[model samples]
Every structure is written in structure tokens, then in C-alpha cells.
Target: MDMKFKRNFCIVAHIDHGKSTLSDRLIQKSNIIDERKMKNQILDNMDIERERGITIKSQAVTIPYHAKDGNDYELNFVDTPGHVDFSYEVSRAIASCEGALLLIDASQGVESQTVSNMYMALEQDLTIVPVINKIDLPSADIPAVREQITNELGLDDSQTQLVSAKTGEGVDGLLEAVVNYFPAPQGDVDAPAQALIFDCHYDPYRGVVVHVRVKNGRIKTGGIIRMMSSGIDYKVEQIGIFKIDYEPTGCLEAGDVGYIIAGIKTVSDVRVGDTITNADNPAAEPLAGFKEVKPVVYSSIYPMDSNDYEELKSSLEKLKLNDASLVYEKDNSIALGNGFRCGFLGLLHLEIIQERLERDYDQAIIFTAPSVRYRVHLTDGSETFVDNPAEYPQGRIQSAEEPYIKASIITPATYLGSLMELCKMKRGEQTNMTYLDEKRVELTYEMPLAEVLFDFYDKLKSFSRGYASFDYEVIGYRPTQLVKVDILLNSKPVDALSFLSFKDNATDRARKVCERLKDEISRQQFKVAIQGAIGGQIIARETVSAVRKDVLAKCYGGDITRKRKLLEKQKEGKKRMKMFGDVELPQSAFLAVLKDNEAD
Candidate 1:
């Protein structure tokens, strides 16, 4: 196979913009998968992905297409997740490709994620073939969408392709454009083996399978390869490309996109975005743009049952291999028992991981409310990071800084005022606002990450009537009046229910949390007092009345004096219960703050 005949490209789009569907059509047209067996989102093999109609993982496949120009081309298509939470996955996938298929919905036009991904592709210096999909829909306004793409992405009219991925309309022309416009992979074949690992996952039998794009030389079976990042060596057990599933190929050469099986036992050794080179003739320098990903949100995940702790640890380790972005540490809460503090890129990332742990690993988990990492500066001129509110320092004298983000929202002009007000309430400072045209606008704001972490997105959707799309990037930390508000039940602090909040909003936040907990927690035999306090001073309080049952029900037919005596004994028992009884908080009580706080 000649390098000139190979083309590597990735598909970038907003969620449900038809990237996966378009890829399926390409595979069908290329005959990579049997036409009769072709299905929508064929690249999304996971049952969860298929059911949700979203691509959760970055997947890749190779197709051999005989173009009308009388030449056979090997096309490598890297399919990426479209959600903002998985933007890192998209970026890593793009780093392995030479071109990108920028897909947009004909009806929705350009979205926030579409703009974000397009800029990312431009940053990678990849040739982009702009595309508009779903033209078959009745709501399709091709001209309007084309104008949006041109106005927002700055792409010329001639560079765009219109197609319907569902019905295969204009797909042939798009494929022709892909082969004609995209450049062939370029590298020296004689150079030492230097492959960039874009993705990897733990295979129970194979140990670890790494997805790589051969940059300079060739990799073959039975050869020694070393990871440049970790300085670990492994014997190449097999090399292959995705043809519906893994099909072992003896060797993968320069410009080739495929997988390497090295029987790797340790997950930490095979890091994604690492360079792999021949151990005998190692490359002097690794590929550029390799950096560790920092988590944006943190949460505590405990098993529903304490007996599943060991199994839960094993499940997390296994899940971590597939998702390197997941970071965890040993965490224990007095109210919730032992658990692991987990970090994620966003709420969706957290949800996907939790879902996978429960469904795939069959481990029921109790998830605490999500939080952002806070940087605390003390009076002693020292600094520390805080992720769990339970671990917040008792005396924070100097200042407290929290992570801030640069957020972008693309929407229609009708909701601009409401959106602006909403952002202001979230302590947002206006950064930039550009009008795409007379009808649509793109607004940018600098807001605290914690404000956006919770109900922001849901509220944005509600306010904009589902027309607004949002994307955000961390913009470092900013100092604020932050305080850790603790929830106490009967004067005993519940670690799982604690949270860091602004001092101005702390009282109101504590009040809501106590109210929510009151509804979630069951009543006890003794009066249960729910108090929210900052340090020793109480800020808010709610009390649940003791369960009062008729102790004299059994003595209904007895004399009045006998009933009075029974009541006296029952009253004494209640007092004893109040003195020694412990309130058993349900798992739901720990997460009550995250719910029923739309206005927060």
C-alpha cells in the first residue's frame, strides 16, 4: 500500500448532527461492511451508545474505496464524540488525522459545539471539508444554514458540501470531495518507528489495546516497542485495523491507522497521546502536544452496600483504563461510609461513568453532589486545593479562589435579554457577544465554574426553549467570598452533604439543602434536627418531628387511668430514644442539594 493512496480524516459536529450516520453511509458505500447488514451509527457498537443515539467513545475504522478516478484509496475515519463533555476525546482523535469532515445540521445551522470543534480542527492545521446534513427534513433551510456556517465558521461557499446522511443523498459527491480535497498522510517510511497513540483500552485477554497512527516508520508483530512518555517497553503481540471489528494485520506502516496489542498488564504504562517507538532504535524526540488532562468536576462515589467495596475498586480500575480522564482517590464519609472521590470533565462525563459502572460492572453506586476544585489561600501565606467540602480547612483567613470558565452560548436573538440576565445571576461577567446575523447571536461570558457545574445547562435550555447551545473552557482561578457550608443532623455534621458556597448565598443555600433533606430522610422515633452551619455558627435549620404512634392503641378498651399510665411510659421512652438514637440518613438525602434547586 502506498502512502499517497491513504487518507486519514475525522468527523466533527454537534451532537446529533449526523456524524455517526454519515460515517455509516461511508462504510456502506466503501463496502467495508456488507450493505445488507448496514445499520445507522454502525461505528457506535456499544449498546448504550446505540440506545442513546450518541457516540460516547472515539472510534476508528479503515475502508478501501475504489474511486471513479481508477485508483484504490485506503480511508481511515476517526469518529469522535460530539458532546462538549467529551471534547477532549475529539481533540485527541483529531490529532491523529490529516483532515476533518465538519458536519452541521441543516435545520439547527451552526451550534456552539460545532464552532468549538471547527476551531479545534483549525488549530490542528487539518483540512476541513464543511458539510451540512439532514437536508431531507422538512425544516431544512439549506441557504440559512449555509449562511450561518459561513458567518460563524468563516468557511467559503465553495468549500461546503450538502448531504443527507440518513437517505444517502449527495453522499457520493461528499465522498468524492473527501478524496479530492483531503491531503495524503506524509512521513518518511525509513525513519525509526514513531507512532502517536490516540486511544487505548484494557482488553481482558489482550491486556491493553492501543490505537495508533504510524507517523514515521513501520511496526510489526514480535517487535519491541517502548512508550516515550512512561519509558516502558512491550513486545508487539499483534497489529490490526478496524474492519467492523479487529482484523489482525501482520504489520502497520507509516501513515497507517490501526491498533497494537502488546500484552500490557499495567494500565498506567499505555497512556493515550504518548509516542510509541521501536526500542532498538528509539526516536530522539517525542511528538508534540502531549499534556495531562485536569479534571473539571469532582464527586464522591460510594457503593450502595459496603460489602461491594473491593469489587467497586476493581471496577473503577478497569473503567479508568478505558477512560484516562477519570481520576480517583480513597475517600471516606462518616455519614455515607467508605467511597472513592472521583473527578470528571463535566456532568455528562460523570453520568456516563456512573452508568457504565452500574450497568456494565453491575455495581450499584451512591453518587454525592458534584463540585469544582477550589484553591484555598491561608493566613499563614500557604495554599491548598480543595475538592471535597468535607476536607475544607477550618480557618481560611486570607482568601479563597475558585475555578472560572469562559463560556459561550449560541442562540436566537429573541432570548438574548433573558440569557444575559441568567448569566448575570450566575456571577458572570460579559466577555464578548457577536451577532451571527440579524436573527442569531453568540454570547461569551466569564463565570465561576461552580455556577455552571450544576443546573446552569438545564436552566439555559429551559430559558432558551432548547434553542441555545453552550460550550466552556477553564480560564484559571479567581478569588471570591467562598465558605464551606456543612449540614448537621442532630448536631452531627454529615460530610457527604457539605458544600462550598459563596458567603452571600450560603444561608439561602443551606436553607434549601435542609428543606430538601427533610423530604428525603425518613422520620425517626426521636425529633431530628437538620442544621446548616458554617463552622460553629448555625445558618439555617429544619426539624423533622418524631414518629408519634398511639402507644395506648392496644389499651383502647382499658380504663382512662390505665391509658394515662401507658402514655406516661411511652413519653419516657421517647425521651430516651431522643437522647441515644442515631438518625439513619438515606442515600437520597446526601444528594438532595443537587435536586429541587432550580433557582440556585
Candidate 2:
């Protein structure tokens, strides 16, 4: 294929705004797959993605289109995830493209993530084509969406394409617009081979299959490729582009997007955002790779069985190969044994990773309560950041700070008051507010990241009746009154149950955990005391009553003294048992405490 006819673009939009559906339409229009086998979100291959109706990973496909101008073209576009947590995936997709299809729902108009993704595409200097999707809906407001494209996004309205991805209306015109509007990828095919490693996945048979976008020259089978970051070389076993599935092309030239399979066994050898070049004749310099992603939420992942520690470690390494944003390190706990401290973009990202591990890797795992990284200044004139409560500074006389995020929420005006009240309950401080129109409002707030980690998103959806769209970015840490709350079962501290909380909410949080533990812990021979404590001071406590024997029932209508004596003996036995008995903490108890604000 000629470089002039190769077009690289990505489909970007807010969550549920028809990015994946639009991709499906384009794929169908190109006849890439048989019509009998076609399905919704065809690019989303993961089970979790289809079940949840969300694209967790960015999927790329090559569409062979014959333009009306009688020129054959190869169009490569990435269908990106729209959630704020998966913004990193979108950025990676944008970096590999020369343009983007900024899809906006006609009914919903413009939302928060829609604007965020536009700015990201603009930052990369990619050409954007404004696409209005879902025009077939009864509530579709094409004029209002066009107005937003002009006024809100600052994009020219004349170039906008109105199409319903569901009904496949006006799709051919959009396909023509893609070839005519977007610029062709430019690179010198004669230059040394240099490809950017945007993504990769581990294969049991082929080892690591590296997904790359060739910036210059070409990559061929049997060529030795070197990772610019790690400087490790491997023999390229195969090279091909994705046509729904991998189709080996034997060689990938400049401006091409495809996968290169190298017989590399170790997962750490290949790094996302690293440049791949011919080892025999490498490029003079590596391409300016992607910016490092910093995770805001941190939690520990432990296996159900201690013997699965090694398997868990292997699974994480393999999972990291696919999800570059996942950050993790070896972690240990007294109660849970060996595990890994993992960092994720948000609660949703954390959940997806847990599910992928269980479903894809067949690993049963337990995740501790999520926590945001906190900055702690110790009394010894030292500064430390703590994401794990177990590593919190023991004596912290100096001030402490917790991570804060600037949240942007777009909702209907009808739910503004309740949404504002919800933010206030989360200890959010209003930063800005704007009315997008008479019906829609955008609210901005600065709030602690920890407060938003648990139920804030769920509450935002419920309060707005699923009309609100929320997006946030972590700002710098702010001064906060922080305290470490520990859970003790029968006087023994469970390190896995410890967490850091705002001082004002520490007592309430501790009481909630104690109560949850009480319900989860079953009755024992002796009373089991579950206590939430700060240092030596106990903030909250709940007692699980002891299971008693029917000594009195056996006595029947015996003498009163006999019954009294038996009762006294039972009391003495209980006292002795309480001194030596160890309360068995079930996995359910830990899980119960991890759940946030569930009904008792």
C-alpha cells in the first residue's frame, strides 16, 4: 500500500456515546468480517467488556475501503475506552493515530469526558472529525450537538457528520469523510526501522506479541528487533496487522499498525511506550514515547490460597504486559501472607483488573480496601508518602497531607441541587459551575481522592438518575488531619484491615468496620471482641457473643442450687476460655469490612 492512501485515526468519545458501535459500522461497511458473524462491539473481545457494555481496552482494526474517487485505501482506526479511568488507553491510541473521530451523542450533546478527550487529541496535534452519533433516537437534537461542536469544542460545524451507528444511517458518507478529511500518515520508508510499542500481550505459545506503530523504515519476519528502553534484542517470529484477528503480512512498512511476535519469554523485557528498532541498524534516537502514568488509587491483592502466591505474581506480570497502566510491587501482610500492592487509575480500573485476573488467569484473589496515597511528614524532619496503612509512619508529629482531585461533573439542571448536596457530603469544595444550556449544568469541585474512592461515583449516578457524567484528575496533596485506624480481632491486630482515614471521619469509619466484623465473625466458645483502635486508644468495639451449652436443660427440674452451681461453673469456664481462645477471622469478615456502606 502507498503511504498516500494509508489513513490512521481513532474513535474517541464519552462513555456510551457510540464509539464502539461506530467502529462496528465502519468495520461492516468495509466488509472486514462476514455479516452472519457480526456482533455489537466486535472490537471488544474481552468477556467483561461485552457483559458490562464498555470497552476496557483500546482495539485497532484495518479497514480496506475503495473510495468513490477510485482509489484503494487502508484505514486504521482505534476504538478507545471513554471512561476517565481508561483515559490512558485513549492517549496511547491517539499517539498512534494521525486523526480522531470525536463522536458526540446527538441527544446528550457534549459531556465532561468528551471535552477531555478532545483536548487530548488537540494536544497531540491530530486532525479531528466531529461525529454526531445516535441521530435516529426520538430525543436526538442534531442542531444543539452541532452548536456544541462549534461553541464548546471550537471545531468547525460544517465538517460534522450526523449518523446513527445503530441503524447504519449515513455511514457511507462518514466513511468517505474519513478518507477525504483525515491526512495520510507520513514517514520515510528508507530510514532505519523504528516502531513505537503502544501495547503488548503475553501468549502461551508465541510468548510476547508486541503491538506497534511503525514510524520509519520497515519491520520484517526473522529480523532482530531491540527494545530502546531495555536494549534487549529478540528475533521477530511473526508480523501482521489486525483484521478482526491477526493476519500475518510477513512485513510491516512505515505508517503501519500491527503486532510483532518475538520469542521473548520474560514479560519485563518489553515495555509499553518503548521504541522498537532493527538491532543490526537501529535508529539514531528513540521516538518520544508516552508520558508515565501515575496511579491514584492503591490496594493490596492477595490470593485465596497461600500456595497461589507464585501464580499470582506470574499472573500480575502477564496482566501488566497487556495493561500498561497497572502498577504493582510485592507486598506482605501478617494475616494474608504474601501478596502485591497494586496501583490503579480508579475504582473501576481496580475492579476490571481483579475480574481479568480471575477470569483470564484463573486466579482467585482478595483485594483490600482501596486507599489514596498520602504524604506524611515525620517528627524526625523526614517526609514519606504512604499508600499502605501498614507502612504509615508510627510517630507523626508533623503535618500530613492527602491527595486531592479536581472533579468535573455534568448533569441536568433538575438534579443540580441534589448533586451539589452529594458533593458537599463528600467534603467537596466547589471550584466552578457553568450552565452548558438551559437544561444541562457542569459543576467542578475539589475533593479528597479518598472520599471519592468508595461510593461517590455510585451515589453520583443514583442522585442524577444516571444523567450525570463525571471526570476527575488528581491535584497535588493538601493538608489534612489524618489518622491510622486498625482493626483488632480478639486483641490481635489484623494488618490487612488497617487503613488511613480523615481524622473527622476516623471514628465513624472505625465503628462501621467494627459493626461489619461483628456480623461476619460467627459465635465462638468464648466472646470474641472486635475493636477499632488508634494507637492505644480504642475508638469503637463490637462483641460477637459466645455459643453457650445447655447445661441447665440437662438438669431439668433439679434443685435451684444445682442449677446455680452449673451456671457458675459455666461462667468460670467462659472466663478461662476467653483468656486463651483465639478468634478465627474468616475471609468473609475481611471482605465485609472492605465493602462500603452496605445495609446491615
**Local distance difference test, per candidate?**
0.89, 0.92
> Which segments of model 1 are wrong by more than 4 Å?
549-570, 591-600
Residue-by-residue lDDT tens digits, candidate 1, 1-600? 999999999999998898898988888887866677887788887788998889989999999888889999899998899989999889889999999999999988999999899999999999998999999999999999888767668887798898999999999899888889999999999999899998988888878899999999899999999999888888999999988889899899999999999889887777788899999999899988545788999999999899899999989988887887899999998766898999999988988998899888999888877889989998889999988988887875589998999999998999999999999999999989999888889999999998887789988999999999999999999998988888899999888888888788899888989998888889898889999999999999999988899887676585889988988988899989888998888766655566454346
lDDT of 2 at 161: 94
Poorest 10 consecutive residues by lDDT, candidate 2: 591-600
For residue 317, what is the lDDT in candidate 2? 96
The residue pairs found clashing in candidate 1 are none
lDDT of 1 at 305: 90
TM-score of each: 0.95, 0.98
TM-score of 2: 0.98
Off by over 4 Å in 2: 554-562, 596-600
**Model 2: number of clashes?**
0
- Report the lDDT tens digits of candidate 2 across residue range 1-600: 999999999999999999989999999998989999999989999999999999999988998999999999999989999999999999999999999999999998899999999999999999999999999999999998898899888998989998999999989999899898999998999999999988888889989988899999999999999998888898999999999989999999999999999899999998889999999999999999889999999999999899999999999999999999999999999999999999999889998998999999999888898888999988889898999999988775598999999999999999999999999999999999999888989999999999998888888999999989999988899999999999998888999999899998999989999988888888999888889999999999999998999889887686899999999999999999999888878887777677654221
* Candidate 2 local lDDT, residue 406: 95
